[model samples]
Target: KREFITDDDSSDVTGAHVSKIESTIMVKTEASSVVLTQQQTSHLNHSQQSITTQQQQQQNVHIKQQPQQHNNIVQQAHPQQ
Candidate 1:
């Protein structure tokens, strides 16, 4: 007497994997600015005046109205004794 045993099997497997990534960037800047302005104005005026004067005077006068007279007399006598 002989005995025989036989086994037959079939297997199937399916799998799926997915991955996503995101990136960000940054930038920096520095700057300086300046402005200046100036203005000036001036004015001047002058005036002057002068005056002078001088004077001189002189006078002389004379007058005469009159008359003058003069007289002289002489007498002599002699006696003998």
Candidate 2:
């Protein structure tokens, strides 16, 4: 038997319409903010770019608290797991 499979999952948003977010963060003693912009690279394709950026932010944020009962429920939501 000969069979093949194709996984097709993409958005209706066109390449010309969709905006890519490439942010630069400024870490200071007082506060921190990111400058959001659309950036393009030569080597990486859209699929690779999308996969990398999807999980990028979750790696940077970790909340340390007293206990589960006293902790903020809103902040406890896991995006990666």
Candidate 3:
């Protein structure tokens, strides 16, 4: 059996003095699914330094399984310029 998965997404962040940050991640397989979520907060002395950031992520994965042979998995991610 062989499986392939790909994800491409963009995110926008809005905050003042780094009030809060949150993220979620998910992974799925034929048998089950796994998910994780995390959040963090930051306090800054100067409110004028607050700003928003935008980011984009692209990922590609390839998985292969063989009955009488070895299994193989390949994953790659694109870096921002």
Candidate 4:
């Protein structure tokens, strides 16, 4: 069997779940009737932010900090090493 999801004219929709029982495919995609709580939305936002930050950090290390002003600065900073 095959199933499809569509953007109906319903705005109060929430979760679209599908389950198989015996030889029948049950698809419940009508409406949520109840709005999602604020906690759920906040959790999603937090996860997205963390992912974005981690990606940015992995992009560059010392490429973001300022470089030495002149050769003198470099010599003064690292004399032996």
Which residue pairs in candidate 3 have backbone atoms (N, alpha carbon, C) closer than 3 angstroms, thus clashing? Answer: none
C-alpha lDDT of residue 65 in model 4: 41
Give stretches of model 3 more than 4 Å off: 1-23, 28-60, 65-68, 72-81
Q: Number of backbone collisions per candidate, in order?
A: 0, 0, 0, 0
Question: What is the alpha-carbon lDDT for the whole of candidate 4?
Answer: 0.30
Model 2 ranges with Cα > 4 A deviation: 1-50, 63-80
Listed in order, each prediction's TM-score against the native is 0.07, 0.18, 0.13, 0.15
Worst 10 residues of 4 by lDDT: 26-35
lDDT of each: 0.10, 0.30, 0.19, 0.30
lDDT for model 3: 0.19
Better of 1 and 4 by lDDT: 4
Error of 2 at 17 (Å): 12
- lDDT (Cα, tens digit) per residue for candidate 2, span 25-66: 222211121112112321232334345543333322321223
48 in model 4: Cα distance from truth in Å?
A: 0.8
**Which prediction has the highest TM-score against the true structure?**
2
Candidate 4: list runs displaced more than 4 Å. 1-38, 52-81
TM-score of model 1 vs. true structure: 0.07
> Which tens-of-lDDT digit does each residue in 1-81 have in candidate 4?
122234441322532322233212211111111112222433443345435544323222222242424434434643443
In model 1, the worst 10-residue window by lDDT is: 54-63
Task: List where candidate 1 sits over 4 angstroms from the true fold.
Answer: 1-63, 70-81
Candidate 2 achieves a global lDDT of: 0.30
- Looking at model 2, residue 48 earns an lDDT score of 46
